[model samples]
Target: MTPAPFFYSIFGLYLNSNLAIPGLIVLPSVSKVDVQVSFNEFPPALQTNIELKQKIWWVSRYKDENDRPLVTIWQLENGDYWRWEYGDRTEFIIDRKGTQIWANWPNNLTLEDTVTYLLGPIFGFVLRLRGVVCLHASAVAIEDKSIAILGPAGAGKSTTAAAFAQAGFAILSDDIVPILERDNHFLVQPAYPRLRLWPTSVKALYGEEDALPCLTPNWDKRFLDLTQPKYKFQELPLPLGVIYILSDRTTSPSAPFLERIPSNNGLISLISNTYANNLLDKKMRATEFDLLSRVLAKVPLRRVTPHADSENISKLCDVILEDFHKLSNNV
Candidate 1:
C-alpha cells in the first residue's frame, strides 16, 4: 500500500503540498522560523543555505515555461505563508530555516538582493492571509470590540489605528484584520506585531517620530513594533463588533456625519476596502463574498464621513465606543 502524500496543519488549515504538487515536501518547525522543503527532482543549492537568518518551510513549482519559479514562504509563527512567482528564467524559493535563511535562487541575480526585495511584501502577505485581513483602512478596539476604519490608501487608516492605540484601546490589527466565519460569528485576527505607518502619521502620534524603524531609506512609511510597548497583539481571534466605512467629507462638509448602509452595500464596501483583491480569482472572490455576507448579517455596519483632519480620530473613536457599549450590553 502507498502512504499518504502529505500531512500538515497551520493555523487550523490542513495543508497537503504533495497532493497539490508532486515532489514537494513542506516541513515547519516550532519556535523560530524554520522550514524545509524536499524536492524529489531538484538537488539542494550548495552555497545558498548559509545566507538565511531563519528557516521557513516552502513549496515551489515550475511554470509552463519551466523557467519561472512559483514559490510560497511558509513561516511557522502565527501559521502564516505567502505565494509569489518570479518571471521566466529565474525562480527563487526563500524561507527561514530556524534562525538560518534558505534560498533557491536562479544563477542570474544575487541571492542577497532577492531576499531583501521580497521579504517584506512576502511576509506582509503571509501575515495578511493567516489571521489579519489586510484592509485598505485602519482598525481600533472600542470597549473590547473592534471597529474597522475603512477607506483608500491615504485615507488615514493607519492614523486612526495609531490614535486609538494611544487613546488606550488595544490595537486589534492595522491595515488588515482577517474576518473569519466560525459557527455564525465573525472572528477578527491581528496581522502582525508591527504597524506600518506613514511618516506624517508617525510624527503626529509620537511627536518626535525618529523613534520608529524606517522600512526603507526614502520611503514615507515606517514600521512600529507594537510588541515592544506591550500592546496586546492578539494571537487568538476576536469577534468583529462593527464595520465603519470611512469616507472623506471635506468636499461635502454639510453631509451627515454618519449613516447606516444596507447590509449588501456594506458588504460591497468591505470588499472594496480589501488590500489584496488583485490576487483573488473569481472563485476566491465568491468565497470571500459569501463569508462577508454572513459576517455582515451578525455585525452592524455604518458609513462614516469625516473631515480628514486630526479631529476625525477622536470623533470616530467616540462614536464607535458608544455603539460598542450598546451592542455589548444587549448581547
Candidate 2:
C-alpha cells in the first residue's frame, strides 16, 4: 500500500516521510527539498555475526573480530540497523542520502513507541551520516541568540528551558538540539516547540499532573506545548551563544551559579554530552572533535549548578539570562 505523503518541520529541515511520525510537528505543506523518509521491507539476513556493542532490546551495532566496523550487506548498500521492542521489530537501511524504515510491532504496543525508537537513536545516527553535529541538549532563544543546556538524563534540561518560556522567552528545542557551523559562526537549528516532561516536573511547574497532554497514550510523560505566538517557537536557526552543562546541586543551598569551563576542558565535556556519541566511529569522532574545537572558540562553555531547593528555579533562570546576555554581546 502507498502511504499518503507526510510533511514535518524539525532540525531546521523539511522532511517528507512516507510513514507518519506522530511526534514531530506536522507541516501542512512545504516546498523546500530536504531529507526524504520512507517505509519499506528490510533484508532477511543479519549483515554480520560480529557485534560491537549490544544495547538491550534497542540496537546491537556490529564489528568484526579485528574490531573493524562491518560494512553494509544490503544490495542497495549503505548499512543496516535492527531494533526490537518487546519482540516487535524494525530494520533500517540508510546512507547519507536518506533512510528507509521498516517495522513489525505487537498489537499491544502503541505506534508512538514505534515512532520514538525510529526517530530517536536511529535518526540521530542518520543525521551523523549526513555530517550534521547534534547534541543531547535543550535550547532556548534569549533575545537574539540561543543558549543550549546540556546534561545527563534527569538533569532538568527540558524543565529549565521551559522555565525560560515562562519568563517571557521563546524555546528553540527541548531535546536533541542540532548545532551547525556556517559563515564562521555557530548556529542553533530550531526544533519543535514542545517540551516533554515527567510527572514530577509537571507537578512542580503547573501544580497539576495533567497540565499538558501526554506524549503517548500509555506513558506518564506529558508535553509542554508552546504553540501560542507570544511564547511560540523560534522558526529559524539563531546564532549560538553559549553552552551550559547543568550539574546536580552538590553544594550548600545558596543560589544557582554558573562557572566557566576553561578552553582545555571544553572538548571533553562536549564529547561526553553529545547526542549519539556512542554510535560514532573513529573518523566521525575526529571530525566531531575538530568541529567542537572551532565551536568552543566562538561559543562560551559553562557549568551551571542549580540550588538545592527546587523553589530556586526562578532565581536560576534569572541569573542564567543575565549571564547569557552578558556573554552574547561578544559572540
Candidate 3:
C-alpha cells in the first residue's frame, strides 16, 4: 500500500504532496488542495505531442561543466505546460494552471536536492503562472504591515531579514515574496518558517559560524529556525507598507541610511528583482509591468546602504524600523 500524501500550506496555496517537503510546516489535513506534487520515474528523454513554444536558454547562475546552462526550461503545449531540466539530471513538469507538478531525478540525488529547487524557483514559477506578483526578495512583518527587502543575490536580503527576526519581528516570506493586491493595498503572503542564510551572514547575526544548522546535509547553506521563540513567523498576510531596495555595502564612516528613489528607478529595480523573471513571456511581462507600476505609485521606495561590517546587522535593522515607524506615523 502507498503511504498517505502530506499536506502543506505556503504562499496562500494548499499543497498535497506525495513526499514530505522539508522546512515547511506540515498540516494534518487541508480543506482544499490547490496544487499536487508527485514523484515518479521518468525516462532520460521526454516525449510530447504539442509543439515546443519556447526554450529559455538558462535561468540559474550555475552552469554545467561544458559551460552550458545549468538549468533550462521549455514551454510546451502552447504554454499549458513547462518542462525543466537541470545539470544534475533532475527534471520536473508543471502545468500552466499551477495545479500539478511531477518530479524525477537520478539515483545519485536525494529528495533534499530536488527540494531546494522545488521550494524556491519551481513554486515561484508556479505562482507566476497563477498570476501572482512575486519578487526575488525577503519580507518581514512589522506592526500592521510588512516590508520587502529587495536586492540582488548577494545583497544581504536574507541577512537583513534574519536581523529583523532577532529584533523580535515576524518574518513573512523569504527568497520568493508573493504579493496580492486587495482593498487598494498589496498584502504579502507568509512563506515557510525558516530563513536560509550563508555562513557569513549567520556569523554576522549570531556571533558564530555554526550558529544555525545546515539546511541539508548535502548543502552548506544554514537556516535560521523561526519556530524558536527567539524568532517569529507570520502566518497571515500583512498589507505591504514599504519597499526597501538594499544597495551594496558602504565602507565609509557614515552610518546606515535610507535614500528615497524616484518611481522610475524603483520600477527598474522591481523589474530586475522579480522572481522567475527570465521565463516571463510577453503577456506575463506586460502584466508584471502594470502591477509594479501601480505598486510604485502607492508604496514608498527607499534605498538602504549598510555598513561594511557584518556585525552591523542590528544597526541596519534599527534604521529600517525607524523609517518604517516614521512612515506609519505619516500615514
Please name the candidate that would achieve the greatest lDDT relative to the true structure: 3
| TM-score, one value per model | 0.63, 0.83, 0.92
- Residues 1-331, candidate 2: write the lDDT tens digits: 3434788877877777767777577778788746666555433443454244223322335655655433222323223443332323334444434344454455666667666555666567666766778889988887778889999999989888878887778888776888888888888888776788998878777788898788877668888778866577888899888899999865566669989998889899998998888767687788889898888877889899987666777888988888887876754
Task: Please list the residue runs of candidate 1 whose C-alpha ends up more than 4 Å from where it truly belongs after superposition.
Answer: 1-135, 208-211, 249-256
lDDT of 1 at 11: 26
lDDT of 3 by residue, 105-129 (tens): 8888888888888889899989998
Worst 10 residues of 1 by lDDT: 16-25
Q: lDDT winner between 1 and 3, please give it.
A: 3
lDDT, residue 257, candidate 3: 83
lDDT head-to-head 2 vs 3, winner: 3
| The 10-residue segment with the lowest total lDDT in model 3 | 42-51
Q: Candidate 3, residue 189: CA error in Å?
A: 0.7
Which candidate gets the maximum TM-score versus the true structure?
A: 3
The C-alpha lDDT values of all candidates are 0.54, 0.73, 0.87
- The parts of candidate 2 lying over 4 Å away from their true place are 1-4, 39-98, 228-230
